[model samples]
Target: MHKEVTIYDIAEKLSISASTVSRALNANSLVSKKTQQKIIAMATSMGYRSNTFAANLRMQRSNTIGLIVPRLNSYFMSEVISGIESVTNDAGYNLIISQSMENVDKEISNLKTMFNNRVDGLLVSVAAGSNGLTGFDIFRDRKIPVLFFDRAPHGLTVPSVTIDNENAAFLITQHLIEMGAKNIFHITGHQSVSVYKERTSGFKRALLAAGLPFNENQLIVTDLSEKAGIAAAKLIAELKGDGVFAANDSCAATCMNELKLQGFKIPQDVKFAGFNNDLISRNIDPALTTINYPGFEMGKVIAAKLLDHLSHKSDLHSSPLITMKSELVIRASSNYKP
Candidate 1:
């Protein structure tokens, strides 16, 4: 049977006292930094592993953070998580990730689990329902730092990292208007989510600014899926709208395909645009016009903020919102000059 390597073995190999080795391993200030580095190197060469359980017990910290997101399947969501992992891993921390699957009940349950695990901090992208954050009070009471990103909940003054959704939406709508599209239809996800609500507001602001009627009939809300895109295209065909702005690239791409099948020409018959510069947006016929949302950057910002709070380097109360930048990417789909 193989035996586990210990600090005492490392000390014996280095001809040093076990107490000195222990102090070096724990990064005690009493141990000189140079000696600590040498001891660490020797420990690594000797295949010694520190007892994290004991270390954590002494420090009263888990060295772990909890992350909750609406879903993990999308490219945007996955990239955000990857960015977070990159930052946390370099900082000697681990992430415990959970997906709410856009269900309020599941989100509440995940929150409970995070609390039970005694995570050092929490990062969240809220789910779609109004009751998605029923468990938020517990974290507040426990004095745990919670930072939200992307689909943050409204009315919660918790520090968050997000882009100006309303501004981005307004830009896209205005671009379609500038392209000589008079009747523009807007397709989006559930308005309960803050991102969708802000986007809807932006769309309305643009239409009203252009002296166009705010037609409720032209707004379609769905799950932002490919199926939703198909349905939205069918509705637009019936309404005979000149342009469309779907909330996501998947829906936008699928909507374009559906519109083409229905004998509509891209940008010629009906101009199309979407949000989130997803790969599907670029790969589609007449690449989609979209807003380049900085998902990965948002993730890095949120992780940095949470880590700063944990390290006492920043105060969450001072800044309630950390806004990232997003830009409009014009493509062939919305550039037809005819």
Candidate 2:
């Protein structure tokens, strides 16, 4: 195995004092830029890498921000993480991400791990049934800055970046109604989740406002997975509706595919709309109508805010609840063109 190169090696190679090499590497203003450049060049030539763990230990900071999400495979979440990486990576900070898989117990375990690691900050999008921030007291007690996005914890005053879910849902439902859908079915996840609840509420509101009957039977709650979408499609086949609104595009796309296999013509037979204008939504045989939730932009905004707070450029206590803008994207799946 190759031995690790150290500052002592660089110092010896350059015939300079170890302290001088250290100051130069640290970019101390006391050391001339010319000397610093020479030390840096020598260090690079020797394949020297700084011991960041040792440095972080001395600073009493990990220089790492922990992130927790419900799931990591989703297109929206992936885009959000990419945005976060773009900013945090450039700032020389690292992200430690984990998924709860929508389980509260797993979320608590992930939180404990992040806390034990002493992450500089935490970003989370709470899992289903994470009810009332019960597991987040430790962060509050320790004064750790926590930012929630997308499916955030309810009844908690935490800094967050997300879209106006209810308003977006209202617009989508109203659009379906405008397209002449009277009996619309809403397929979503747990109502305990704020995003799903807000979306379901908006769907009911649109129906009630239009003097259309808001059938309790039409609200189908599930995990919103692709398998769930297929199952929901099978059920919908038995009890059909004029339209359907899913909480996310993945399920909507799969549901559309399943419906097609079951001989249901989209838009003409059943208009379908979903949240998050994911690539799958656009690529489906009949592109699905959806709300453009701007996942990447939301990520960038959230990461910037968190980084600013960590760097002390912004106050954590004064962190704002940021809401990103979204618009309904009409597509062939939901639009009826004679």
Specify the highest-lDDT model's number.
Answer: 1
Q: Give the Cα-based TM-score of candidate 2 against the true structure.
A: 0.83
Angstrom error at residue 324, model 1: 0.9
Mind giving the per-residue lDDT tens digits that candidate 2 earns over 214-325? 7688999999999988988887778878789999999998888898998898889889999889999989989999999888888888888888987889975685577789
Flag regions of model 1 displaced more than 4 Å: 1-52, 131-133
Error of 1 at 336 (Å): 1.8
Angstrom error at residue 175, model 1: 0.3
Question: lDDT for each of the candidates?
Answer: 0.88, 0.86
The clash tally of candidate 1 reads 0
Candidate 2's C-alpha runs over 4 A off are: 1-54
What are the per-residue Cα lDDT tens digits for candidate 1 across 108-151?
99999998887889999999884435788998887898888897
Q: How much does each candidate deviate from the true structure in C-alpha RMSD?
A: 5.9, 5.4
In model 1, which residue pairs have backbone atoms overlapping below 3 Å? none
